[model samples]
Structures are given as C-alpha cells and as structure tokens.
Target: MSATSRVPALAPFRVRSFRFQWPADLATSWAFEMETLILGWYVLVETRSVLMLTVFASLLYIGTLLSPMFGVMGDRIGHRYVLSAMRAVYAALATTLMTLAFTGALNPVQVLAIAAVMGLVRPSDTGMRIALVGETMPAPQLMGAMSIQRTTQDSARIAGALTGAGLVATLGMGPAYSVVASLYAISVLLTFKTGGSRAAPNPGADTAGVSAGLRTASGERETAEAQPQARFPQTAVAAGDASARPSPWRDLKEGLAYVRTTPHLLAVMCLAFLFNLTAFPLFHGLLPYVVKEIYRTDQTGLGYLVASTAFGALLGAIALSARGGAIRPARMMIVSCVAWYAMLLAFAYTQHLASGIAVLMLVGFTQCLCMITMAAMLLRTTDVHFRGRVMGIRMLAVYGNLPGLLIAGPLIARFGYPITATLYCVIGLAFTLLIAVRWRSHLWRLEAPANTR
Candidate 1:
C-alpha cells in the first residue's frame, strides 16, 4: 500500500556482513561449478570409464562423513573463520592439481588421490555456508536472504559450467585449472578483508532452544556468560563459548538425536537423501554420457546441458525471491517435486537438443524451488547452537550421492544411459510419492517462518 512496501524484498542485502560475504561466496560457487564440469570431463577423457566418473564424484563427498564434526567446529569457532580456512585449503588443493596438470604429470589415480584429499576439506563448506546465512541475518529476513543467495549462487554455477567447459574445449585443461585456482585466491582475500573473524553471533542460531534443552537435560542453567541470549534482539551474543559446550562427538550425537525426535525434520532429511541418491546424480553425474551417446554432442554440448539447468535454476530462484509471500511452502514443495521429476523423465525420452534443454530448464526451476523451501524450513526450525550440527546431519544425508554415484556408474555402463535415467526417475518418483502420502499432513502444514514449532 505504501512506497516502502512496494519495494522488492531484499532486506537481507541491507546487512553489511552479508554484502562482504556475498562476492566471496559467488567466487567460491563459481569455482565449485567449474570444477564439477572440468573434472568430470577430464576423468572421462583420461579413463573412458563411466565407473571412473562416479568414483571421481564420490571422492568429492568422502570428507562429508566428517560434516557433523565440522558443524560442531563452526558452532565453536564461528562459521566465518571456518569458511575462510576451508577456502584456503581449497586453493591449496587446486594449486596442487593445477601444477600437476600443467606439468603433464596428472593421471586418473593421482586425480583420485587429490579428489580424496579435497573431499576431506569440502564438507565444511556446505554446512558452514548454510549456517552462516542463518548467523548473519535476523530470523525474519532469512528466507529472502537465502533465496537471493541461492539465486546468485545459481547464476555463478551457470557461469562456472560455461567457463570451465569453454576453457577446456578451446584453451585446454591447464588454463581452466588456472582460472579455478585464481577464483579461490580471490575468494580467500575477500574472506579475510571483510573481517570474518570479528563478525557478530548468528541471530538465527537457535540459541534459546539449545540453551533450554541443555538446562532441561542437565537440571541447571549454564553460567551467565555460558548462557545464550534467548530473545531476538540484534545485540544478542552466541549461545555460549565453545569451550563450555559438550565435546564435538557429543554435540554430533545430540544433533542426530534431535533430528530423530523431530518428525518433520527427520522426514525432510530422508527426502533430501533420497533425492540426492536418485535425482541429483542422474542430472549431473550422467549428463556427459547422455550428451555423447544419446544427443550425439561433444564436450561443448555437455557444457550446454549443464549450463541450461543452472540458468533455469537462476530464473526459478529469482522468481521465488521476487514473488515472495505469494505461495505456500507445503504446496510449492509438492508441485516442485512432481514437476522436477516429470521434466527429468521427459528429458530422458527426448531426442532433440531443444527439447532436452527445455526439460532441463523446467527441472532446474522446480528443483530449486524444492531445495530452497527445504533449506528454509530446516533453518527456521533449528536453534543457533545446534544449527551447524543439524545442517551437518543434513549434509551427511546429501552425501547419499556418494553411494548413489558409485553404484550408478556400473548400472549406467551395463544398461546404457536411457535405461539408467528411467530407473532413477522411477525410483525418485516412488520416494516422492511415499513422502507425499506418509508425511503429507505434517509437510502440508509446515511453514517457513522462524520457530514454526
């Protein structure tokens, strides 16, 4: 009704800390997308094995098993510091691989080793980044902030895929690796320059919930300084000093127990895991073969398909962010789940390049809607002290891809791309339908606002 109300919801951008962290995240997202394209193709070129591609993909998530520990680390040391350190580690690993590529010493086994090493450090990035978003923005602005962040990250993903594929096609892997290394370097500089070390406590960290849980369990309040700020005042501190908290293993177990006891949270996590196992690898891990074998295209074509999905995701995310509050989370999730899988199914049957791209765009749009809603729901429900650990649990579930890819490689090789794609889609649909039936009542009522419980 008023001019201020007419302005688009971009409240989270008004936060100074978010602005500084924004570009660094973009650079990091770009680096990740580029690596996915470059490394997947490179491994294929060298080994000519579908199983190898899956192996390479698995290497990326091997470190994710430790995600719960890293989540606890973030709760202790602050996500900003954790994120900066992880980026630096990424840079170092990228540099090592880059040097190997430039020197003509790179091979599949060596790449696999590097990938395994990278996996160790990579798990922290997702859990920390998601938790950091909750940390930096107030609870009220979180959904919008997350949507905008996802939109930007998707844009970078498009850029990174295109850039990685183009560079590898035209200039070669050496130059592509160089660019990846460069992006990491810039991200590191941006990370520290923005003063990550001094950033304030995360307002969305669920400090009150964890504090109360601890008090109830232990039958006493923590020391005044060890206590969390229970209210949403801007000046609130962290739940407590990390040292006063339980051990990391204990925290991880407690996080697991919390998810187990929380039905909606547990349901959402199981769906996420199933989606990763069935839908994600089909879209990303098997695309190159789909391009070459089915579409009769080259590396450039593979890049095009990947980029199209990202472009679609960017559009979908932007629309969701801009059209804020017009849709309900529960219905959107159901529609997105159905649409995303249906598009993927259609894409598998199509022979034309245009049709493939169209289906991918739809898939991207719907999948983004599903994922963003799921994330917003999880963030809204969890407490600040437990945020990292909870996200860690979620991340571990996402590593469902680790096994999915490993098993899929052989299946795709044995049955061919079309059959493999069909099977995955069927599996995904069955899981989605199960969730819709079993969790329908709860999920339908689930809202994305803070403290929905």
Candidate 2:
C-alpha cells in the first residue's frame, strides 16, 4: 500500500545529503541573484547603455562551453568535491568584488571582468547540484526533490531582488556586496557537507559502454525508457571487456553519442536553447531595460518586477512539488512552453507597471512548469553514469541566451522593445510547434517513454 502512497513535498529532506544541499543550494542561489542584480544595475547605470548591460549579462555565461569539461571533472572526482570547489570560487570572487567596492576601485569594467571570471565556473553550478541530488535521491522522489530544488532559485530571486535592491539603495554597493560575499562563504561551507564528500568518485566502477545501438549494453543498466529494442552481443562484449577507465574525451564522446541518438534528449535540448534564446533573454536578462524604459521606474520598482516573476515561479514549484508524480511532466512541459510564449507575447505590450508585473508572473509560472519538467524528465530518464555529462550538455543550451542577449540589444536599440519582444515570442512559438510535431512520437504522445513517471 505504501508503494502508491503520496510522498509529501518535503520528503526529499529525509535524505541526509538533501538536507545539507537544500540550504547550501539556497544560499548559493541567493548570492547568485543578488550579485546579478547588483552588477547588472551597476553596468546599466555607469555606462548608461542597454547594450553594455546585455554584454555584461552575456559575460556571465562565457564558461558555458566549458561545462562538459566541468562535468568530466565532477564524474572523475566527485560532484560534491566539484561543487565545493565551485562555491569556494564564488566566495573568493564575491569577496574580491566587495573589497574593490569598499576601496572605491570598482567600476563597470571591473565588474564585467569579475563576472567573466566568475562565469568560467558558475554555469555548471546548477547541473552539478542536480547531479548530486540525482546521485542521492530515489527515483520516485526525484520529481519532488527537483521541484523543491528549483525553489532555491525561485525564492532566491524574490529575496535577491528585494535584498539586492534594498542594500544598494540604503547602504550602497560595498556593504551590499559584503552580504553577498558572506552568503557565498556560507554556501561554500555547506556545499562541503554533501553525501558524496565522504567518498572519492570512481566513475570506472560504472560499467562504461556505448549505450547506443538503440540499447543499453549487457552490463549497463538505465531507466526503462532508455532500454534497447534488442541486445547486440558484440557491442556489449566490447563495452564489458574495457579494462581501462575511460578517457575524458572518450567519456565526453560517449555522453555525446547517447544524446545524438536519443530522441527525447535531443528534443529537450532544442527547447532549452529556444527558451534561453527567446523567453529568458527578456525575463531574465533584460529586466533593467523594461524597468527603466517601459515602466519608467527605479531600483525598488525593478526589484518588485523581478520578485513578482520569481514569486510566480515559486508558486509553480510548490504546486508541482505538491502534485508529485500524479501529473505527466512531458505533457505539461509542452503545454507550458506554448503557454509561456503566449504570455510573453502579452508581456511585450504591457506599458503599465501593474499589467507588466501581472503578465511577468504568469510568464514565470509557465517558465517553471516547462523547465522543471524538462530537467526532471532528463534526470529521471538518464543513466547514472551520464547524468553529469548530459546535464553539462544541457547547460550548453544556456549559451543560446548569450546570442539572444547580444542580438536582442541591437534589435531593441533599432526597433524598440515591443517589436523586438514580439519578434522573439513569435519565433519561439513557431519553433516550439515545430519541435512538437517533429518529436511528436517521442514527446507529444501520452504513451511516450518521456511522458511516463
């Protein structure tokens, strides 16, 4: 009877690692949001240019190309170890910024440089966190765990927006960054306590093999959805006979091979890029422009706008966590993707602050529904050995936002926010529909493997 029982929203905390990770992830996320808002506003104001602001935002993801390598290191060392090191980097960078601010040496150029340095490690932070959770949590609890994990970012956004804005306005930049650095230090300490910290990772212990040939190798096991149609003995034997640990290049290739062959992974990746390119560029990267230009507002007003969006996402995460596995994530992802773009189309035209805030909330809500499912489906279905690399590749999709931001700046400057946003939303809607039709068998069908819990 307990097999069918409803696991409560906080069930993931029953796992010891998650207890440490939830707070660690929360602190880290809070610092990240605060740093982003603070630095982003600094760039916009000091330079008095939206183009400079977008460039500053784009610099934050410059390390995205390196994510797969970071995954390789995590797999070779340990997710916990990599995460601890990354958070330390965060602390160090934030402290450096805080120092510069206090010494009156801080400027927009220095902020951009620090962001670039921080970007080299920051893009993989989320993937590493998810990989660690996937390593610790049971399959049945993954949906709830990820939903709760997502709230770390959602709630952090709300807190970051309010606190970042308040700190900057009241106490000024140096003191605000002191708080940011302190949070990063706390997160770094907490990250060191994850479950895997007790053991060195031995990835070779995983029966490494090409899970291609439309099947898992003989010694390799994966989720039912990724099971092969028929076993091919030779390939399985060659894979099983491998005596040496896979080279990072080999591991990377193996990770790539699976994604190349898996229809669902491919589909998820495309959508990931599409959203980053279109939806996220505005909601996430260009909020400053919207706050200043469209609404004619100050830092406090911008904080409210960002918090509104995050509040909606927080609500969505709670609802999805509460629902658990009762709903089909793949189905919901598609529906929400469509809904997100539609809501975005409305957001493009909202000239009033109240209306813009309302639409942004819906935009964030649908964004949560779409992204959480995309992540959960990937984690739930991916093999344990490939989780790190696969998620790394998923982070690569975030690189789309750089181009989206870069191009959006020019477009907005030339055509205006309304026209640029409308164009982006239309393109997103078209591609989402295309992806659905092309991968209908893999994603749209109710019986699709990706659709199953």
Which candidate ranks first by lDDT, i.e. highest?
Answer: 2
Q: Which whole-number lDDT from 0 to 100 does residue 261 have in model 2?
A: 76
Summarize candidate 2's per-residue lDDT along 1-453 as a digit string, tens digits. 332245578788878899999999999999999989999989999999999999999999999998887777776677888999999999999999999999999988889999999989999999999888888887788889999999999999999999999999999999999999999999989988886432232222222233333233455545323532112222233466433354677567667766777788888999998988888998888999999988999888889989999999999999999895887877899999999999999998999899988998998899999989988888777767677888898998888989999999999999999999999999999999999889999897877768876
Per-residue CA lDDT of model 1 for 354-428, tens digit only, reads 788888988899899988777776777676656777888888876888888888888877887677778888988
Strongest candidate by TM-score: 2
Q: Give the whole-model CA lDDT for all candidates, comma-separated.
A: 0.76, 0.85
TM-score of model 2 (CA atoms) = 0.90
Candidate 1: stretches off by over 4 Å: 1-6, 193-244, 446-453
- The C-alpha RMSD of each candidate to the native structure, in angstroms, is 4.3, 5.6
Check candidate 2 and list the clashing pairs. 215-228
Off by over 4 Å in 2: 1-7, 197-210, 213-243
TM-scores, in order shown? 0.88, 0.90
Q: Model 1: how large is the Cα RMSD against the reference?
A: 4.3
Q: What lDDT is reached at residue 351 by model 1?
A: 88
